[model samples]
Target: MVSAGVYLVVRIFPIVQASVVTMTVVAAVGAFTALITALVGLVMNDIKKVLAYSTMSQLGYMFLALGVAGYTAGVFHLINHAFFKACLFLGSGSVIMGCHHQQDMRRMGGLAKLMPITFVTFLIASLSLMGIPPFSGFWSKDEILGSAYAWGSEHGGAYWLLFLAGELVAFLTAAYMTRLLILTFAGKYRGNDAPTEDFVEDQAKLQSEQENWEIKKYDRSLGGLKTLYREDEEPEKHEEHRHVPRESPWVVGASLIVLALFGGFFGFVGAVPLGITWWQGFITFGHAHHAEVNWLVMGISTAMALGGVFVAYIIWGAKFAVFMRLYRTRLVQVLQAVLANRYYMDHFYNGIIVRGFMVLAKASRIFDTWVVDLIVNAFGAGTKMFAYAYAWFDLWVVDGLVNLAGYMWLGIKRGIRPLQSGYLQHYMLVLIIAAVLFWVVRYFF
Candidate 1:
């Protein structure tokens, strides 16, 4: 919907002719929708839904670029969003599957210890989504924001407001993703139920079996025995063995390798065109279409994204500091509340849409059962009762007369039964007599 709305606005409203009023309105709508989607996703318990909402909000930033006619920047962001968002969603799915459908982060903790592959994958994706440098998201988001800042310089208050909002949303994005990681991987287990112990026992047993097999193979090789030997003939096995459950190193190593290649190559390619000359065929082609490098802008954008990561580390990373203790003050509590509630946007929507629908539903039910049904039911019942009385009269009086004619015909047939003969000719004559007798009886009656 956000993408469609943006495409519609860009196609219908010519950028050159659109007034500041139109641009501002389009930008606000896009930004607000994005922010709301992100906030809702953050609070959602379902992991997939959270990523879905995050996708919606991320696209809002892209749409904001389109609304401002930053087509290249928008496209760049769109491409980056695809990579990081897919990684995040899939990584979360992997975690959910590993944990046997436990998606509520509140119920999950210390998963990094159990499923390191999923944890590393999730971390890389989350960092990318947070717009960290060397990741795909950084280049694209920086381009979008840089364009916004440029627009802010020309368009007075509205564009500046949008730029500020984008910054705040960026901070929130980092904070919530950090919160997710901390709850899922950093803390001790806080769930109500304990994990099944059987899995641990099974893993231990498997490790022991693998160790015994390895030792047997080593013994066979050292003895210079080409043929297999019975276990009783093998050398004595060790009584104690260490159990180590390590993931295939290639899994984590391979993902990092791919992501590193993509992160380095995509940005360098995008930057190449800025420095190439016309004489340099391929290099010149890149330079012609690339964005002009503004060292100041790049520095500021890189600092913002890095600052977010640094802040996250200080609060929840491996070396978390105790700065949260200072937030115990009343003023700080109020500020935290405001941020947590998302500045009451959810409350405002609940009041307007949810409450309004509830009231409308109550009124509709009353109107349906009382006013509408009362009049219709009363009229229908009265008409039905009148028709039923008329039907009773018709059944007794009109039907009785018809039955009397049937009884007279029956009496005439019975009276002629005695005169009937056994022969065919005699029977035909008896039928004619009976018809004459019936006509006479009807005329006299």
Candidate 2:
């Protein structure tokens, strides 16, 4: 949704007029979204979510291609990504199911023995995703790169920047995928305590100890660790053991079949034609044609792919592989650690965006509580006091004035009580006297 919003803004708003800027913005948004989604998915402990994030990241690459106007190449990649990504997700689901809800690769080892079919399917899908030769991903990805290079040549520096970013992203992608493969399939089982060879050994030792105890109970003076027990107290004899490595033919066969098919028909017989001529249009940007195969380019590409495989082998392949022991060196160990941490990209984001936002949030909270809320609360308290004062004034002063007026009226009624009697002559004499007194007082004044 955020990506779509950004796209719309960049499209409708005339401020961002440059095509290169628009494309760059789109690529940036896409890449950010992919990276965020992938990280979230990985942290959430959901197998499906992991795949979803991977798909999102892969789509980011496609969008990057499309933004650079490599439409055909991007579309091709989108299709292939969908195919192999689906296979990978489903295959991973199968592995989870076979492992009885163990989605964590850390809990799994030697599953190539227990769930051979799942392993093979997973291997193929992983290879395809890694862009191994003749797999679906290689063709599409190469096309994207070729188109990016062509665009960079046709345009100016911007396309070149995009191409460089894409290449860097590709290297990271490979590294992470390699890490995933190593942790998933190549390690020793590191799960919780269960039935293992160590457990079996401990159990056998315990039984032997119990048997020896019983023998000691019968024979008081058994010398040292070597004690011959009575017939009744003898340890139960167990059969001899032999270690035999088991192979899952079904899984191996399925893997071999797909790999063989992909190897033989990947470039030439599959969806995209694999011949030199077919790739010529892509590599040359539809400018040139060659009548014969270009073994040189093919060889170089193959060598690069194989080089990646060899690197992976050296780092995390079978224990007996010649260079495997060399990976235990300090330099290789540090390199692996760096790769596993995604070259500190996560740390960088956390330091910049996450920690920055956290600081802003804390500051906002303090401002709201101390500044804004304090001012608002003060105003509210003042308004409430003013209202209370008005109520007090109305209750005391206004009511006191009404009461005084009532008291005056009552006094007038009491005074007029005497005049209510039948005394007209007396009342006229009193009124004449009151008038005489009022005139005397007025003249004196």
What is the TM-score of each predicted model, taking all chains together? 0.59, 0.59
Off by over 4 Å in 1: 1-19, 34-53, 106-116, 179-269, 272-290, 318-322, 328-352, 377-445
Q: Residue-wise lDDT of candidate 1 within 1-445, one digit each (tens)?
A: 4356545654555552257666666667767867777666545545676677778888788777665656566666665666666667666766655444445665566777866776776787777777766666666666667767777877767578777666656765775677678767776543434334743454355456566666677753322221233553321121122112233356544664465445333543344225522212232212343455555656666666666656655665554346666545688677655644667876888898889999999999999999999999999999999999889878887887888889999999999887665789878887899999999999998
Best candidate, lDDT-wise? 1
Report per-prediction Cα RMSD to one decimal: 15.1, 13.9
What residue pairs are clashing in model 1? 273-286, 273-287
Tens-digit per-residue lDDT, 48-155, candidate 2: 545666677677777666565555556556556655665666566655544444455554556665555656666666666656667766666666555556667777
Residue 295, model 2: lDDT of: 45
Candidate 1 lDDT (Cα, 0 to 1): 0.63
Ten contiguous residues minimizing lDDT sum, candidate 1: 235-244
